[model samples]
Target: MFKLTLMPQNLEVHLPANSSLTELEFELHGQESISFGCRSGACGACVIEVMSGAEALGARAPCERNFLASLGFDGEQFRLACQCRLAGNAVVSAVAAPR
Candidate 1:
């Protein structure tokens, strides 16, 4: 399982391998100020900043790349939480971008 740690609040959420980032976000819902929309990775509303353990998440998908491009998010540190699949273990922080 992977661990998602929210910064400042220090909240932690565990996600199993093969678990989608959308599922993890749901699991962590209501715990913090995180928000999600268009769970299919087209809205880019669930973008997050990988604080550490990026290796735990699966590689970026084509849809995710397109969405990020549409949102003008070119930084390598950003990821769409809905499109990422847990591969191992990771600690992530919510970016709280506009929907």
Candidate 2:
């Protein structure tokens, strides 16, 4: 199993290995803060700041890397929630991208 924390909101969620963050969002749908657009990882709307447990997240996909880079975000702590699948456990905070 894996643990996930949605910071600021201080929400905690437990998920089995190989679970996608998208499922979490769906479970918490209508919350406004974790909103996502373009589930394919093409848009930055789902980006989140990883507060810890970086190693637990699966490898960053190519599309995710390219999109973040295009947005001038090079830090490993930043990731698109839509592109991430928990491999172990992670703590992250939802962040809205600049318009």
Query: What lDDT would each prediction earn against the true structure?
Result: 0.73, 0.81
Write down the worst ten-residue block by lDDT for model 2: 25-34
- For candidate 2, the TM-score is 0.87
lDDT of 2 by residue, 28-93 (tens): 656644768888888788888899988787778777877887887778888888888898778899
Error of 1 at 31 (Å): 1.6
- Top model number, lDDT: 2
Residue 30 accuracy (lDDT) in model 1 = 61
Cα error, candidate 2, residue 83 (Å): 0.8
Q: Can you tell me which runs of candidate 1 are displaced by over 4 Å?
A: none
What's the CA error at residue 81 for candidate 2, in Å? 0.6
Full-model lDDT, candidate 2: 0.81
